[model samples]
Target: MSVKEQVCSLSIGIVLFPNVTQLDFTGTYEVFARLPNAQLYLLAQTLEPIRSDGGLTFLPDTTFTQAPALDVLFVPGGPGINGKMEDEKFLEFLKIQGKQARYVTAVCTGSLLLAAAGLLQGYRATTHWLSLDLLEMLGVETVAERVVIDRNRITGSGVTAGIDFGLALAAELFGDAIAQAIQLGIEYNPQPPFNSGSPQTAPAPVLARVTAASQNVQEIRRQIVQRVVTQLQTTNKLNHIYFA
Candidate 1:
């Protein structure tokens, strides 16, 4: 069997948290769900329903403890990532899974969570444009791109880029033909009415308005990243002392 055929039985786990951006997870979910014989898990701390920042609700089907070994470990980002950044249990879970998972992936602010877990420290990653600074503060090499792939780590930038990330990752795992078929099936052609997707392409007033609105949240994220960085540093020191 080819690599594509081998991956047909691959297990994929998507970490879901409260206030997660629905599109960040669902866009990639739609594509991964179409994978032939792939087992996908909506993983969470519990089996409870998770509410998105946009007010949509998703019921997680698997708890972290119940999750099996994953071939792909995916984390999605949203306002919830601030909470996750300092979540020791969640970070430990990622640390354990990430060490063994074949592919460690994230979208939007989710990459920040991966960084907190020490998964992306030396990797070049990207997140929502608004959170790129926070990602960098976590000691990750920040890339301003739609999608960035560094070895086994694949990360995507903000909301809509999840689709692009999904397609690219699918092509990497399966084959170009499979990814093309999936894209066509989803009718993934995008022709936006406005070209204001990026800060560079957006109107000056529009950029100012969004950036202004995001200032407070950005500060909060910065503080969280600081604490996480200190904690990671402390832990590394202790680990080195013990191992030495």
Candidate 2:
């Protein structure tokens, strides 16, 4: 590698909490792992094997307490983040690291945790379509797109959007030539058989059923988001007073 490239090595850390959606991490992991100067770390609360929502288990390379300063802090969303959003220490860790990282990123509902940690205030962001309202509730200007980038905060719309998020970040890091190479390596051209990826195109009946089925989960998310929002507001007020 040339001297210019030699200095490009970056510390990239992805959260690996239990019940995380593996694809949310793995899809991007595959891209970053192959990048010219990316050093990837799987971070979790423990070093034990973390089971993903799909039942796949992966071991963490480092615990949150042991994680190094990261160039990029990536959070992947799943049912798991529901509890982590309420974890004060975890939130504090994210808040500190996110502020320091060059890029604060998330795929799917991971944006919720970032917002809960008070990182998304005044930023235009996106998340899993179902959770966009939850993001708005937390004071974020939600964008309904595959990927939204506002300053250093980048977010993906939903699960499959992780791949796009990864490529976008790849381009940002190594330039279009390198990103194209990575995309070619992964055969990243996507042409789905179904056109129903979003509610706008999905059949009315199908969308209704899916919405109905997820009502309970949505309610739980709303309740939890309300709590987190309150906490964030209180913390911001305290910080204001302290700084004043």
Candidate 3:
């Protein structure tokens, strides 16, 4: 009898909303795609091509309605998330899929969507430094760390932090050696041109610019959370759900 080769495959679903931050998804994808037994899908609301904030366009392999069961679900953040929170269809989809996914991860502002979907209540998470304060509005404990792992939900701080998040995730799923090998393969060394990653370290002038640029997004996020909270209250879902 001939010996048979055993193959293992893990299905991963990445939600690609319009204007999503490219690095948020790409960095994670680069790590996960290299796994020995993994199948990746670029999922979206529609099957049409979606554009990223950085002008990259990608065609989704599956849509919300047609997607298969996913072992891991990834959500990336960008300005487009401002609209998704209030989108009943999208939120409903997230609610359903999130409950079924083995692992749910978000990068950058993507945590905002997860929070909007009622997945982050009572859980600790992190997002872009500029948006960390907003997590509290949703009743989530905000962590100032680069990566936060709360139960099955793993959240990364900002765009570049996704790389670290991915490596951590890989280690969780496989082993430390696997993650180390992948990190080495990708040459994951960092050297920032400017020190503006955090409020504590960034210069006052740089911090001011960051705050100014984030003001519009912050205001929009506030409004969206208010609306979602009202809806949850009306439906009597707030009592059963923990916001923080």
Q: Which candidate should be chosen as best, given lDDT against the real structure?
A: 1
Query: Candidate 3: lDDT over CA atoms?
Result: 0.85
Ranking by lDDT: 1, 2, 3
Per-model TM values vs. the true structure: 0.97, 0.96, 0.91
lDDT of 1 at 70: 95
**Candidate 2 lDDT (Cα, whole model)?**
0.90
lDDT tens digits by residue: candidate 1, 1-244: 6556677488999999999999998999989998778899999999999999999999999999999999999999999988888888999999999999989999999999999999999999999998888888889999999999999899999988998889888988898998999999999999999999999899999999999999998998898889999999999999999999
Per-residue lDDT, model 1, residue 171, is 85
- For 18-74, candidate 2 gives per-residue lDDT tens digits of 889988988999888888867999998889999999999999999999999998999
Instruction: Flag the better candidate by TM-score, 2 or 3.
Output: 2
The CA lDDT at 44 in model 2 is 85
Quote model 3's TM-score.
0.91
lDDT of each: 0.93, 0.90, 0.85
Better of 1 and 2 by lDDT: 1
Which of 1 and 3 is the better model by TM-score? 1
lDDT of 2 at 42: 92
Greater lDDT among 2 and 3 belongs to 2
- Which residue pairs overlap in candidate 1's backbone? 77-110
